[model samples]
Target: MRIAVAAPTGHVGRHLVPMLIRAGVKPLLLLRDPDRLAPDVRPEVDVAEVDLLDADAVVRAVSGVDALYWVDPPPAGHNPLAEYKLATASAARAVTEGGVGRVVFQSSVGAERRHGMGEIDGLAATEVALNATDANVVHLRCGYFFTNLEYQVDAIRAGALQVLLPVNQPMAWVSPRDIAEVAAGRLLSEEWRGRIVQAVHGPADLSWQQVVGIISEAVGKPLEVERIPEEEMRGTLAGFGMSAEQIDSLVGMSTGFLGGFTPEQERSVHSTTPTTLAEWAYTELKPMLQ
Candidate 1:
């Protein structure tokens, strides 16, 4: 079967494309710049460079695909919902025009809850838009990325670990590679279409303090977890060029953690991904710390 992947050069895509190929499914990778295509994808996969916002370009890239893997980047100017809206609309048009039958959207966990953040709202918009299509749409609401620790990797390397915010709060963190695996499964399996499959997290949950300890062991170094103050978080986020809305959204996310935003118990029933914090730390993060 033919699958069209948007942003095939992204973190998830880098892992996802190989899995799809191994399963005997052909992936049509769509990117804005072909030069960014990874070596593995460039030579073997069918690729198209087109402006994602351009309706004609989207249609051309998506045409003749049986399935789609949608990944929309954060919108410009901190309006998280705007870019997703644009991408979703463009994809919606392409799905109709190109005869694509199924779509696997990469969304965040708790999207259905509409919790305190612009991310929830933006994901909700995309979900609503995709629901309009006749094609089977599956919204894969992923959990908080364990890879978020990459930001703290430097601190771990330096033997001074700074747990950003929500230091004591436990989060259900899932690996991006595991998320990609689940997405690949749904994209290939016909029975999963038209379903809202939420890959909530792995076996257990961990607080930021535990995360630092795991990294310390994996990297073979002793480190201390120094929690960052809430007041400084806004400025730190601003340094990353986040919009006011985006900054507020992230700040609000920490509030949920503090206020007890636990994962629903039913997540294991529909979606089961088995990758723990230590496993992720040992595999993906250990080398980065070195």
Candidate 2:
């Protein structure tokens, strides 16, 4: 049974590769830059060097593999949406042209909407294309990644957390490690067939206020949540030189969340993971601060 992991250097993929190894299954890794793989793991695994943006290349890379873990690489290009569509189209084409039987797509919480989700729309697009195929697919709709806080290193250090969502409203936050575990289970098992939407809701639904308190406790300091206005967020992204479409899409995403756009999949024991904000903060975020 051949299995391959694409974008193996990413947060979840990094964890997924090692988990697959521990399960005694050697996975074929597909990536754009082979050099980015951890030096320690490079000699222990097989790698196919290819540009993910190239559909023909991705098709070739996964051609004979029985299963694949497809996490679209972080959005890039002047138009990230277009880039996302291209990548999804490539993955869809692979299922048809490459003979890959199963795919566990790294999707997001709001992807079920399939429209008006900003950057999440790209993931919805991926879900749409893959769902059209006959191959087994799991739309792993993950929650807001806990790792996103790492981007707040500077902000956290400044004693403030800029949020796009309401501070007191509940929202899901998941660890990437949790996402990898779920993906690995699907890729490793053959019992489940056809397509399904598996939402990863993390350990709990936490409001930004609760999250801020957790981080403050983890770091032994005070932290505050500064709710950034949607239009202001647009200006900030524009200042960062994001494309117009990207800015609108990103602001649109925040607006949706600000409007309390929780996904339809209700929280259940299966959807909830084990890692909590406190655990991730102490283990992952604290170390980054040092």
* Top-TM-score candidate index: 2
For each candidate, what is the lDDT? 0.75, 0.87
The CA lDDT at 118 in model 1 is 48
Task: lDDT for model 2, please.
Answer: 0.87
Return the number of clashes found in candidate 1.
0
Stretches of candidate 2 exceeding 4 Å from the true structure: none
Error of 1 at 269 (Å): 5.5
For 1-290, candidate 2 gives per-residue lDDT tens digits of 78999889998999999999888888899987889988888877889998777899889888899999998777766787888988888889888899989999999988877777788888898889998998999988899898988888998999988777778888889999999999999999999899899999999998899999999999888999988777788788889998898786777666666565767788898798999989999988998887
Tens-digit lDDT string for candidate 1 (1-290)? 89988877676787898889899877898888888876765777888888776768889888888899987755665666566677777877887888889899888766666656445666766777778888898888777788777877766777886544567777677788887888898789887556565655765667777877887788788877777776687888899887787787667655544566655545565665788888988988888865
* Ten contiguous residues minimizing lDDT sum, candidate 2: 251-260
